[model samples]
Target: MTKVQFRTAEERDRAQWADKFTAVAEGNLYRDKNSPFPIHEYFKLGLLGKEVRMLELNAGAALVDHMVADALTELNISSETEGNADEIKDWHKSIFYQDTLEQTARSFFSCGYAAQQVVRDIDPDTNENTYTIITLNSKTWYPTVPTFKYQEIREGRVVSIFSENNDGVKSWYAFVERHTKGNVEHELYKLENGNDLEGTKLKIKDLDRFKELEDSVATDLNHIPIFQIDMTRGAGKYFGQSIFAKIWGNLQEISEIKTQMRMERIKHFRSLLAAPAQSLQRAQRVDDGEALPNNSKQARVEQYEHQATFDLRQEIMAVPPGAQMPQFIQRDLEIITKAMEMIRDCLSEIASVTGCPRSVFNLDEKGTIHVETEKKKDRKYVQRITQCQKKLEWITEQGAKTYFQWKGDKAGKKEITAELDSAFEMTLEEKVDLYRKMNSDGKFISQEEAVRNLFPDMTEEERTEMLQKIQDEDKSLAGSFGDPVPVEL
Candidate 1:
């Protein structure tokens, strides 16, 4: 098979999807600004109620991840006899679960897309099959060709690349080097000026060395292992459209509403802090009265201002006779209260648009969803989880096949399995009740089957032991003349 020049495609695809990528990046920024990380340090003080370093509300971003995480229940995988069901199940429990695929799915939901690639290899010393899973963030994934289907990326000649500086190191190193020479530490050192070697001035000869060093980093960066791009694309028109993307307008509206509310609050505080409008009693002038002591009206007004500061509730000014008092104006707090109402409405709307229940947003609405209505919501999200399962199924199958091939299995047969029963909805009590109903009137459900349904986390050995105990008890009871008491189903 001819090798595809993936490097060329990476450059081409990055440019092709430049606009969309920009939008995703900006959307992520806006999300962080509105929810967790404040767009500015000062903004945090204004919105979050305190001034601190590196603070943001970040609710908008977290809302997306939380909704997805809460909805995901469990993943069950199994395969045919050729697939080594026991080993596959063990792998699912140990390796797959260790990868925290559900958390990765949360990322996919948050970022509009996420990717996983399967790699197969052998342990040379032990001659045992091994697998490697590569998870990619949205930023690193670029499709060279346009493909609507997530699993059909290979046909589109896609390439996923992750790049980072090595702190002047030449080659790529795994695990330990990740901490000593990886991007994070390097950035920290740069920020702290640790990279500045004192008294080490660069000479002309160093230019060549610097250039060589850069070239070496570039060479190491280009060596990306290509993989098939599989995303849990659930009802999204395109891979770039994240759960947050569709409801971005609403999130933005909520963000704006929050900002406005904060301003209104500030306004209210200022009004409270300020002195209240006072009723002034103007002085009346009598032409026949003794001549005033060269006192001007302006002098009289200043005297009244000085007296008022010392606890004068009302200002009494000496004015010409027949002076009319100005109409009293009251502070109208209703506008601020009305703004609060607007904010509540915006929050409810945001929750509605994002498919999140209003309760999640902490709205005060007393409405409750009907049982059937809730089931519909559950079904909608369950379908999303199923779509993600399909992607995982493909990934696991390919990985298994590769593992068998490395072991010289001619057929190279394998299957990746997934089971998301009832969308993670069975309580122990519920399962037990159902089992009792199923076993009533000689309609017996096997102990193993009942255990499997009730406690999926139980191992086969544990289930077997429990089953044996039940069987032994039944035999002991049968030996007596009375009918054997039935074991709990």
Candidate 2:
């Protein structure tokens, strides 16, 4: 790789490669439903696998990885002008080539699985031309390299690198050289010696290693080989066959069988997976009325209490000398000093506010105030009457003495007229007759005053005649408040 420029075009190529390769691996490996190859990588990237967090490798996946590496190399070269390009490469060399990043990376390695194929023409039973390549992928969410593998820079070389897990525990893995021919059978055995070395051993078989390769590939795993990738690829003219990324969740019913899992397996999975823990004690506080607990908890917590202090003691000459209080006691002291202080300040302020000299009984929290005013509360008699319905049997001359009471000298001839000529439809003659009924006892002085105010002075005969005329007019004006009813003796 040479110095290259960082470009969007390069990024697109890299992402596309990751997608295409994953799809190719899935389509090829998952030809049949029962195939053990999990299309995890394919599902994740190209959307070709049926299970979650799984990978199915194929020509496409291999190609995607290969091309992505190629692209990265191109990018680093292009970005030569970037800050410390050569310097960065030098640092990487010091780590990777010098076995610095190996320890941590190895802990997360998990294992390495390989499948070998003969690249030459040969007899099915006895062929002697073959080569083996180990494939590597990550189980962690770490995104350093897409994948890695051990390969000999020369022919006739078999290299196996072994190391214990990060915890420095577990039985040493037994890696033995495998040989194979078609229907090849390799011994599933272990290495007697647990050892460590600066390098590894490599076995190169030119004549044939068929049986060995086949047996090794079928180790532990019941299903065919499937490698998961990041994503899928779209259609291109001279590119890969139209590979569809399988959505893993869609075929979840099938994958469920592979995992042998049910909803019960995730009984509290959704809730547990969605959130973090909280602490109950964090909501508590101290005697100062302050809130306690400043954190969250995943479980319940027990609570406690703190009490106030109070005590009473006296110098008892009759008691024994050795028996005594903690010596920190302040006997007969006011336990509620803060409250008492507050009350004292309030009283002092009130004393200055009112010229009453002392305010020992001011309106404090413990005291009461009965405010008295000199003036009486006035009363109003105006009442609203709704639209008149039937009769409102008010005092009439006949029923006057029965219901009405006089609050003055001898009662005057009172007229109780119906609110007429509007809502209830009354005529002036009815009103005059009604008034006369309420004043049956002549009451000349009062009738004279009524007739004068509403009508005007007139002789007894004239008054009768005028009153009749006005009543007739009120009948015409019945819809209006009847022409002011004429008063009479």
Candidate 3:
């Protein structure tokens, strides 16, 4: 029998809150009126929301690796499976623990920076809102996108307080411990002033320490240490566990994806490097000059018949009757023989017989083949040779537009393009041609909006009919955009 675990009161409360969040997301409060969609996939966004999801995934992967290592050293495998476990371990390392550590730093400030564009509700250059949100790709370094604040978030109690163990809570101090390669105690041994935290109390560290820790963490930005250093609060706070946790979580996710991509690139490069070695072996075998296998029982007979034909064409045709038909010449005979041999070889490859030879053919001593061009008379020499011209319709127009005119000439080869639209009377061919030319690139202009740059000519109703026809009534589709219909857990 299988056992099932039920949700506790706390779990139930969390689930209910999630349900409400999803309900609110269905409304278009976050989006413009033109779109009907709400936020997507909120149910599985985790505790910190989608933006901070990297932390959870990173912590999860680390926990999994540690668990597997524990299981292996503790003999957690079956005897029936004889394969080595190193393969599994190596695979894990490649998937999680590789990186190219890059040292780069950036500072974010609410106030305008020296080099940054002066943004306001409207930027003078683009006429966009001043203080328009800026998003950079950060190709050189991992990108950190800050979400704009809207509401207040609750600050939860800190479970493990560091103030009791350390004299002061400093950024550099936290980082020295965070990136220390071993367990907490092992890291403390190598770290400076690890024991100094025992008696002092200065959570009010200076600006230099804060800046130093920030830059230190940024040093090996590729491989981020997270999950273990989860902040008490999540985001939208001053320098606290919440902010660091948010940063750590995002870095962990980026590292995970980069590791996967690097593995693929390495494998591809290895295979490409082996191509030359494979080609060399094939070349060496051919350099020895082994003769290709051939048999000549059928081919030899064809050669003899070819030679006889050549001799007959040259020696016999030079004189009148038997006088012109002299004895076969050896050189002429050899030429005819080569032609027959060539034809026979082709037949042998296909495993078939050649067509029967009806007449002798040979090159003359003057290197010319004879043709009967002198035997023509004057009457009906060449009946007025009438060439059959395949007439095809070619219709060109003022290429195309949202509107077009279909014109065709009476004597024109084209019966097509008589009408631009179906409402216009046109033959099926004409309509097809017009549509083909216009639609070749699969684009069309529709009667959309031509903005009212100036005022309208006449007065009209306060609200246009287009407004009434639009969906003003909010539909309870899946979620809500505005405040949700609250339901207590």
On TM-score, the candidate that comes out on top is: 1
TM-scores, each model vs. reference: 0.49, 0.14, 0.14
lDDT for model 2 comes to 0.28
What residue runs in model 1 are displaced by over 4 Å at the alpha carbon?
1-63, 92-99, 119-130, 146-151, 155-240, 266-340, 351-379, 403-410, 424-489
- Residue range 1-489, candidate 3, lDDT tens digits: 222222134433332332222222222112322221222334235432334321111222222222122112111111122432333234224433111000000101100000111112335698753221122111111111124433222111111112223467442222122222221110111112322222222222333333322222221111112111011223663211211122333323333343334444444444421112212221123223544335666556644554433221221222333232222222223434554454333322211111111111122223344343222211111110000000000011111100011122223222212111111234445534444443456442111110110112322342343333333443433336565777899
How much is the lDDT of residue 340 in candidate 3? 41
Give the whole-model CA lDDT for all candidates, comma-separated.
0.47, 0.28, 0.23
On residues 1-489, what C-alpha lDDT tens digit does candidate 2 reach at each position?
222221134333433333333334333335333332444444447443333443222222332232222112111211213433343344335334213212211211111111121222235577742211122222111111222222211111122323344377543322332322222122221222233221122222211432334333322211111121211113331111211123222232233333323222333233321111121112223434645565534111322222211112222223234444222322232324443454444444433332112212223333434243212111110000110000111101112221122212135333332211121123456435543643577542245333532443356678777667867786778945655767898
State the lDDT at 281 in candidate 1.
36
> How does residue 324 of candidate 1 score in lDDT?
54
> Which model scores highest in lDDT?
1
Compute the lDDT for candidate 1.
0.47
Query: What is the Cα-based TM-score of model 3?
Result: 0.14
Worst 10 residues of 2 by lDDT: 381-390
Give the lDDT of residue 72 in candidate 1.
Answer: 54
Superposed by TM-score, candidate 1 places the C-alpha of residue 28 at a distance from the truth, in angstroms, of 7.0
- Summed backbone clashes in each candidate are 17, 60, 22
